[model samples]
Target: MTDSATSVFEADLPTLDYGLTDPPQQIYPQFRAAQQAAPVALGPIGPEILSYEMARTVLRDPRFVIPPGIHLSAHGITSGPLWDRVTRSILNMEGDEHRRLRGLVSRAFTPRATARMHDTIGTVINELIDDATARRSCEFVGDIARPYPIPIICALLGAPREEWQQFSRWAEDIFKIVSFDCDLAAEEPVVLAAWDEFDAYIDTMIAQRRRQLTDDLLSELIRIEDSGDRLNAAEVRMLAFSILLAGTDTTRSQLAASMQVLCEHPEQWALLRDQPELAMRAVEETMRHSPSMCSTVRSAGQDITLGELTFPAGTFIVVNTYAANRDATVYDDPERFDITRAAPPPILTFGGGVHYCLGANLARLELSEALKILAARVPDARCVGEVPWKPLLGLSGPVRLPMELCR
Candidate 1:
């Protein structure tokens, strides 16, 4: 561990600008340099959490809460469909309301619950690979990464399989909010308009589900809504919306990211091809190295102390998860992308604590299944061209991955 006595570790140490907007080539080294210093340092926002322990502490601490609309509101977006949609979503909620929403849908996302999608996820992967295998070369993001997760999520929601394309387009556009590269203000109207279209779409689905009362999650939600104590119409819609946003966007970005990392490491790629059971390990390594959600911010609700630092209420600690995941104290040879790295200390990619990603099990199951299937099917898959990457400051992944799947 680095010394805390240094000026670089000063509590007031000027914002540790990791030069987020710069290319990742420049940004990652900056993170590495900072990790050599003390764990806690001030970032452009507040204190950027660097160490895995510190990050874990901050993320799990009860005093820190994610303030709703802090992302868009910081840029002067206060209200509208975009604001209402985000602020009302289950992801941004807190207290009993948050607890209640989570409780209602918790069973639906458990490991056992998500594992039900394993076969469907594999089937989707095979169909997707079959398409790419025929082309030999395909823009991985568009052809595979972008569209692959939609069907599984759709199946969960009990929606028609054909509706996957429409849902994908809407989810992709709506997902731009999580990426720093997206100009939210410029995208607000467009995103809100899509929300309106989605608003109608989901309403129709809910109505149909209400009438037919299928075994789908949506119908279950309707039953809960009608039960009077469990949920209401708005809550039902919001819960479903939260699942859609969290499920589709993160999985899409992460699958592309997983592929991007595997393609970069030919040896690891081949290793995975030979041992498909390593799919879980490979996905973990990919997430540790190339996470989709770049960082998550937690706002302190009161004064707090961690080791040598104190943060006043309202102070925000941004968990640079990508950096913290590589914290040298926890991971051996942290910089190396090795799927076989034994006992990786629970990668902070999906985060920790109560707000830990609701779709984590599903995401992992999806990625693991995808990795094994792809490795087995396209044994020679590799990055054939430069990847147009998303900003490392937000949801990061290849916007376009030129991949050649040589069988």
Candidate 2:
């Protein structure tokens, strides 16, 4: 790891306090200021890498590796039994271990498999919309966004249908550890308890799968083999933990944020309603405009020089993807939310290189299908009340998006 003291760009940059409930729009100015100042500068938490090119380079660069478990513990977050397994899972892994795990999981989580979920995803969207429409005015997050991804992920994992809500709560609790803006010491106890319960749930599910094999992602993962090597029970449990944690609230946040964007910009909504072909493009635009996960943490594994900045191993770096995606140098009128925006460079919302999100394909499919369904069914829908923002720095989206549907 790069030592922070030796980094060339170690000058103190302006600090911005990110409240868990602060809206993304409120936080953009600070990122823009940092981007204009330097490619890499000190953030309130640590060093920040700002700018699309620099962030992309760092993500793809082998020198910038995922921070180890000790780094997280230093932030006042101690791990539980399940939390320990997940931190050592593929998400935090590096080099050969990451490659092997990624390969094994890819067999079960393929693009083709994601494509097959399109019909099911569409069905879920319509059902949620139907329920919202019947109410005329409903809290969009609770009614649609929150419930939408739960069953889909549960079915994919082969977990019991009744347990989706339980998984959702656990996933939500676990995500608190990732929020740089939150009170980690205060939230630690709840997070630990949630992990214990989640671990027990996953253990029981794994034992059941062992007894009677089912046809789901979990079963496939358990049976998946790479060069005659199979995942152990602990690895399988962690993978399930990863999928549930990565797939649920993150997808829900993205969906809610995209919906909020469309509601705010009715003109864009009208364009999508008229030309449904723009659904996928709109999803891309929303991701670029308001990414669910704004930033990621990395540490320099060895001495490295990026741009004018040089750092020794052990330096902490924050890749500000939110700022990067909206870089003026990369996009014209970078702040505008235009669905018809022409083919631009790929956004860093899903990240880049080896550590890129494994569920990117599935996420894109869900967002595209979600927008298409919304355009077709609720063209006149509009936000009706104060949309509450979740108080988390790592990911930002509305907690309750109240909306009045077309009667």
Candidate 3:
């Protein structure tokens, strides 16, 4: 949005590891305090783009590739099922191969498709709140956040809906690999164990779907695989796993973060309660202000230049959505968390280009609906105890949110 003719060079850059080492609460504030565009190198995490204009440039350009495999390898998770699982995902894919796989399944994630689940999502959240209605208090994370997204995503994939806790646990452990707190080498067992269970679960589901076609995404994938038009059985399995992994805990964290932010802004919470229709814009502000995804990692496939700066090939960098979302150069009052702002510029929370999150529509819908119900039902909800954060910036949210339940 702010396409100023500013130029940046490594010599003048800050040397922070982005949010890796700072206290979670200081991430954005520290970014705002910095005079440089970004760190010369974010320690082992690589360089980052902090300005709104440069972040957009790097993300939309085809030369900056999503390189999960290389990042994981650098962290000592060189090989195993965990490595194989991430490296083969749509997250790590590129070029024609990426397009081919995405084309076959993209229809299921479209806005129209996700919109159909809105009422269903509302039903689930209402039921979740109903279950917690009698309690004097509840751990917001475990009671509400964890169960909220599980059934919706599972139902989307046509998996067993009753296994919400199982999937939640798997997602929690598996997602740690992306968090800065994760001890990759030490976490191999827990992460792989989750993958193994998820793999077997899909194995059985695929077998059943093969016998009878359903109207779900998995059934669609199986049909394509059997047709032998382009997809293979392994691809189908990984694709299913990828969707499940992507949609589950990430959405959970988002809902939790949304609730936390709203807790801090009770007047806005009152507004959402009084006018439920404002849910969408309220959730958008939540994302722009306290996005679950703080940054997106990328690697330059070839030497690339931005204004007066030129970066060599293999340079890993991040589109610092956390920083860019609050760039004073872009928003009139960037630090203000107001939901009623008109025509807010595009947020880089979901990133851009072909690597943009496929489940973004659903995730947004989930959070908005969750907020709608939450505001109506828990209007007086307040955090009664210390709120533990996820220790790292990304996939960022409160680890455990303890809140008083309204009767």
Using TM-score, give the best candidate's number. 1
Residue 392's C-alpha lDDT in candidate 3?
A: 40
lDDT per model vs. reference: 0.79, 0.81, 0.77
Per residue, candidate 2 scores C-alpha lDDT tens digits across 14-37 of 565565456667777877886787
Any runs in candidate 2 off by more than 4 Å, and if so which?
Answer: 1-6, 10-22, 69-75, 78-83, 172-176, 179-214
Consecutive 10-residue window with the lowest summed lDDT within model 2: 1-10
Candidate 3 C-alpha RMSD relative to the actual structure: 3.7
Model 3 global lDDT (CA atoms, 0 to 1): 0.77
Kindly indicate the candidate among 1 and 3 with the higher TM-score.
1
Model 1: which ten-residue window has the lowest total lDDT? 1-10
Q: What digit string (tens of lDDT, one per residue) describes model 3 on residues 1-407?
A: 02332223334567554445453566655567652445332433666677887888888898889876765775777777778778878878999888888777775677987887887798899988988777857888899898787788777778766776677778778777665666788888888888888888888888888889897777767665324565666777788777777787778887888898888888988989999999999888988888777788888888777765666677768677777888888877887888888898988888888877888898889998899888998889877788766634446778899888776
Q: Roughly what TM-score does model 1 have, to 2 decimal places?
A: 0.90
lDDT of 2 at 67: 81
